[model samples]
Target: MPERGARDLSPGTQARFDRFSPTGPKTSLLTVPGAVGAEVAGFTPVGDVMGCVVHQVGYTETSTWSADRIGQLADILRAGYQTALDRLVEEATAIGAHGVLGIDFTITSPDGLVQEFVALGTAVRATAGPRPRRPFTTGLPGQDVAKLMLAGWVPVRVAVGISGRAFTDRWGRPMVNEWVGNIEVPMATELATAVRTAARAEFTREIGDCGADGGIVSDLKFDLWPVHDVAVAAMATVIGTAITRFREGPVAPTSTLKILPLTRI
Candidate 1:
């Protein structure tokens, strides 16, 4: 598996790895305060890293777009995100970093059918203590990472959930009345709810897959557009960092902020 992972790296990425030296000066994307906070938490910034992928989406059937089609769309999106993230992790590993922090994702569709996903972050190495088998990844800022350590928890990885849907069934055909007065559309409401629920479920599954105790949701996004002027297509995304307990017993609270289950929104 490790060999396969290494083989998957692009030539450019491999060159980046070959040029990296542990004793050389490093670049970082963190602010001064963020760097200080990470240092206080026993980590030293190694370098800035990025990973990206461009995907082409194609539909097998060209009839009316439905929820089933949306499922395939979501699958393609999920693959793009995972591949990009995996490359990001590989870069961190090549640089000898124990983790990547303050990670952020960007997605853009240049055309109607082609999408690009990119992940960026600052890689860090532990100044002391044991490291995990694989480098951890997180979207938390440096200060937040420090606070989490003080609270006896450590970030595992970034978790993502995405779901897309289109409404074209019996309940959705009436939303296009040209002469009807403006009013709330039940079909739209249902579509939103369904997509959100599916996305959240996927997020939970991601957390579980990483063997984390729970997750801390960092963002939620939704997009909707009219499909052929007869149906509406919607996509929902949830992003968060999965975390696990490091200390056996309860630790002192880092702040007065409530410490409810991070998995719960």
Candidate 2:
């Protein structure tokens, strides 16, 4: 049993726990300009950790009218990204880290059929006490983590959402009550609605898996293009770190009084 404090750890989680954790009790001397040391806020940097995965992209046929043609691509992406995330967690856990901060994710298409995903971050542990059985991952920098801790909240993990979209463009006719000769372009209202719906649905599902009650979001991105000239594809990817609120917002900093220098009498 590691002395770590990941509460609510299930039997499955414990089974996978390392039988032992080596004790170094070392401090990270690495410094960032304008950033406070981890020790000042009761944390110790374990090391810089990373994880990566490469997945082959399946070929998809194009269709001008059907959007479901590329739904399977979404599933493939989901699996690939999730694998990368899992590997990242394993690395952080191996270091006996309580959480990861300043996480960076990278995506590259090594070839037409193969894509790679990489996760990188600095791992750290709380010095004041044991951390949760499972450490959290975040894109937040070390300074932000320290500041948030003072406010009574801890980052959980990085959440990701991805959705595959396809659309067709064909202004078949005008779609407005023209004042005699109205020439308003028809709105792709359904396409717009579908885009939001699918992307958000994918994002919501990804965050749900992290068990985060509430958190911040960022890096929501999209890649849209037409392949084979018959169908348009929209690939939306959103990234952010999830957080768990502490019992209360950060405690108010204790006040200190410094008597002004006495006037020379």
Candidate 3:
């Protein structure tokens, strides 16, 4: 009888690879200082803290399945995690945060299919001196910044719009219909300027109306449509939190602040 070919151990071996593993050394954990309950216990006033969120490019089910077939699903998932982490880090850097605490991650799917990957964290300046090792707990009625940390969440909305037209410029190149052959300035410039101005105003107005301190502008989309005429339409959005500061009571010594696991409490 012909010798049987070597059995395929790849599938069996590959199954083990699907398990999730920590991307890097767990030495980089961060947490917000102060007792979450203190804000509500009349111990300390709630201060405004900058927040930011970031998402990774979504992968289709097909891509994910294919990665599994190639025994690369772990790498793909890790890549997604890193992408989100990097985005949060970039935002923290922009805010001049010494360290980010209460970091969280979340995975969302609108139709039961993985639709988005998100990362979020509070950007805060750490108190000077050696950091405390554990979180203290106290009684409060306000949101617990530590417990409310979400890993995968989309940011609040800010609106943006862009518009443009195509015609031939003074240079004889095809451009917006109304413009002469390739004019010195592109016709789209006018529409762009108008839309940009409107977008900024709208963002400011929205934030003010919502009682938010500030918002992060992102995913500003610009689209050029050739409908009826070569008119362009652009859209953009901002994501952030509407924060309200409140003073509870006098700050206390030996305030017990509890750092709960990152999740909705």
- TM per candidate comes to 0.86, 0.70, 0.28
Estimate candidate 1's alpha-carbon lDDT, on a 0 to 1 scale. 0.85
* Shift of residue 120 alpha carbon in model 2, Å: 0.8
Every candidate's lDDT: 0.85, 0.65, 0.37
| Pairs in steric clash, model 2 | 5-131, 5-132, 6-132, 6-133, 151-249, 151-250, 152-250
- Of candidate 2, the 10-residue stretch with the lowest lDDT total is 26-35
Candidate 3's TM-score reads 0.28
Q: What lDDT tens digits, residue by residue, belong to model 2 across residues 71-173?
A: 6667767777677777767766765788777777777885667878887776677877656878788887777777777777778778777777665545433
At residue 67, what lDDT does model 2 achieve? 56
Off by over 4 Å in 1: 1-8, 248-265
Worst 10 residues of 1 by lDDT: 1-10
User: How far does residue 96 in candidate 3 sit from its true spot (Å)?
Assistant: 25
Give the Å shift of residue 199 in candidate 1: 0.6
lDDT for 194 (candidate 1):
93
